[model samples]
Target: MSGVSGFDIFWLIFMIMMMQPILRQKFLEAARQRMIRKLEQKRKSRVILLVHRQETMSLLGFPIMRFIDVNDSEQVIRAIHMTDPDVPIDIILHTPGGLVLASLQIAKALKRHKAKTTAFVPHYAMSGGTLIALAADEIVMDEHAVLGPVDPQVGQFPAASLVKVRQTKPLDKIDDETLILADVAEKALNQMEYNLEELLNGRFPEEKVKELAKLLSQGRWTHDYPITFDEAKALGLPVSNNMPEEIYELMSLFPQPMRQQPSVEFAPSPRRTPPRGNGKSLI
Candidate 1:
């Protein structure tokens, strides 16, 4: 009674270890279902809600809820099938970017589908997301919404990316860690070059693709520079700049799976044994 007992402490730790998965799964499943329901609810228009956030999933334990999962394409396909094929898919994108191959696959699917594909960006769509948006017939954005460079990037440290351009001394002068990272960065940069070139081949004109890739890779924050609404339209993508408040609110009011009753909340992905971390969000 005077102090905490060992048994109680062990019990508490065990409970936490066990509960974390349950809670995470529960939350993600709920979110997925809620969003799915919202997506399906608009069957009248045949819209499939696609949300990919290019930001990191989590930083310091909390998920950034920005980034697209390649795996999500499978789920999205399933959702589309469940709806009437005639219904067009409306993708609401607000992502910075993600895996190049993953983004390419999503964009390819969008392009292939007979259903009309349209992208709406309440905020920003950069990189891979930009690629996907480009595939859409129409892009809807507000004045504040931004589209970023579709450049390729590899995760080299801030230093290595510019070393060759500014190497101050001989190799031996460089720190071991920096040297190692530089080697990795060199390889990564090469891969990025290949990746950007490959992705842009058919997606954009060859001349514009190469030029944009170079500018974008070295752009703001290492991935892309900001491209405003006008630039997006100039890219030959149809654009919609304003969404009236009433229509916007109607869109927002779609049933939230998280808020639904447990009985009808929707089935969690029981097919997944371990928890899938928040199934790629576009917050």
Candidate 2:
């Protein structure tokens, strides 16, 4: 049968059409697996993500609650302990920040680990997220990646905003309750600055460490302001714009949040709070 009969030709065409979707799906699955494997190989570590997606579960178009909270600190620590101490770690961080102490805990682990640690920010790492990145020996970012102000947020307001009340407003005009908050804000900012300095001290000079702590925790910019790779490098962070190609592919696996803005209803307190659950919080 050098040439297929008419019936044979029809069957071949039908078979191709039927197999297209199955073949496409298999191809995608294989591609995804390959991407993950490549990412692991390139980084030379098991990749872990600590990300917070901004959108929250809403009711009638208004965010009624937040789902992501729990810091996977314990889990992360376990993973690190299980790994050979000499092996490098690459943490992919994309968070809006969380409990300060939880972030600090993870940061301390990374700082103490004998292996080189790198933080990869594909989109954004903010607040406590910034704290974790600070602990890493190096920060890898894409041109579009963002790291934000790490100033602690108290209740519904930024600690800096509360502190500003004391700096910019006349003392007499401020209420006793507002004054109390302002005082707490100042104390929080100072404590954050101190801790931040400690985290960066070994890697950076005294002056540079002070500068970063001030810029990140003292709120020179808005808490949500996005500091790109160039801006981060200028600020004396160990930032490299060069990123692995697999990072983008990996990030693509996580879909963007449905909401454009973070839910304002559930404000994380200044103190360290446990994560909501295993639920994801990603940029």
Candidate 3:
């Protein structure tokens, strides 16, 4: 048998590397088309739109559609018109909160629509992203689906993140479990209510709004830890509270997928300052 020369080996390696992107792009486009097909099969859209951003491919790598800035509201509106000028449209969302303003706009559209508008979050929907989900007539999340704490987590103004602006003392300095009996989770949740009040001011009444905000923020925040589908139901989001036997068997550590858009929070990736950084890098 004849063996290939060293030059052939180098050429082969380069060829393989070049082929990777082509193959990946083809796979991605196919996946996008498949998702659209699945939504079409749902039978509820005169205009069926599947909107995914940073959590998926980020709209062909547009910088504006950053991981946290999903300007989906306008996109959804446009898709509805293009797909079906007169019929109702269905939009699917998968995002990890990107831009607060963008999320709010998307949520507003969902709430204003008289037609049936269903929001499906197959993965985690956190912060402002969750706001968009809240506007939906019905939300579909699996038993393992995760919804992040709605507490505004900011760092550009390390002075304003939920765990920051409010804590007069350092948060990491947050006393250990035994010393902190006030359940940080509960307090943060109360704060979440206040923030939502400002965001949804005239949208819902104070009493109803407060109740809605508290229930949604009803749990602790920890990375890689998600509430069971039942736990979310108890928290009171308008999701399809079902847990099929198969999904229940899967580990609950996985985060729900979320695409991002752009905005203040996404302007710069926020970093936690020891809640009291000494103006020097700790790591």
Candidate 4:
């Protein structure tokens, strides 16, 4: 301090103070990059999560979990483009289902990718969700996990359900509106079969592929029917029952349905005498 000039010491202090925030930001950035690299190495692929559940928000003090659509084709396409084209990708899917067109867009993108793709279902993926899973080269699921029938839904109801109703009802009872719905349902089923066949072409033999498409598109099974790993394998799909251990760990991040808390009240403590004996009895 005696040897250094006053201006030199002040300048040194100023520089140190100025660098603090910059150093912190750099350190944080480096740590994030390291974590990403570690995750990629352990997972053996670039991982994406498609977790879908009813999300709610307050509207004038009323909470409602409205059905927000999941037509995220643009976002998915961007993610696909951003991912390394050479490496495999693992998509963790947990959706009940969504629009057919949206799901088809994602499926086509996955199919077009040069590298291998796998879908991991820790719980369930149904309807359109099943369609995307089918597009993957392989599917991994837990013993209890399920993939549901891929039959297209018309408006709010399953198209196959409409067709079934029309068939079972008496001719006199079936009205013009019913006839129209049945016709639309038939066309919807046909379009689904065609799309599925095109997707399954390179993966399976022509005959087997058509059979599988028929099974998926037709109303043979109910929309909510669960297709477990064994059933899926029996249907000639490339499925593996052995899900990765890390997948379970990843599932912990997803939100679960909230259970109603029990109505509990704490009892007030009873009044009690401090002691039985005293130094002197009251007169």
Tell me the alpha-carbon RMSD of every candidate: 13.7, 15.5, 16.9, 14.3
lDDT for each candidate structure = 0.61, 0.79, 0.53, 0.78
lDDT by residue for model 2 (96-191), tens: 777887788888888888989999998888878888999999999888888888898778888999998888989999899988988889988999
Report the C-alpha lDDT of model 4 over 128-163, residue by residue, as the tens digit: 778889999999988888998888777777788888
Error of 4 at 107 (Å): 1.0
Model number with the top lDDT: 2
Question: For model 4, how many clashes?
Answer: 0
- Candidate 3 lDDT (Cα, 0 to 1): 0.53
Between prediction 1 and prediction 3, which has the larger TM-score? Answer: 3
Which stretches of candidate 4 lie above 4 Å from their native place? 1-38, 55-70, 165-172, 262-283
Per-residue CA lDDT of model 1 for 96-164, tens digit only, reads 677767777777667666667777777677877877776676778877788776544535443335456
Q: Please, what is the TM-score per model?
A: 0.54, 0.72, 0.56, 0.72
State, as a TM-score between 0 and 1, how close model 2 is to the true structure.
Answer: 0.72
Best by TM-score: 4
Lowest lDDT block of 10, candidate 2 = 59-68
| CA lDDT for candidate 4 | 0.78
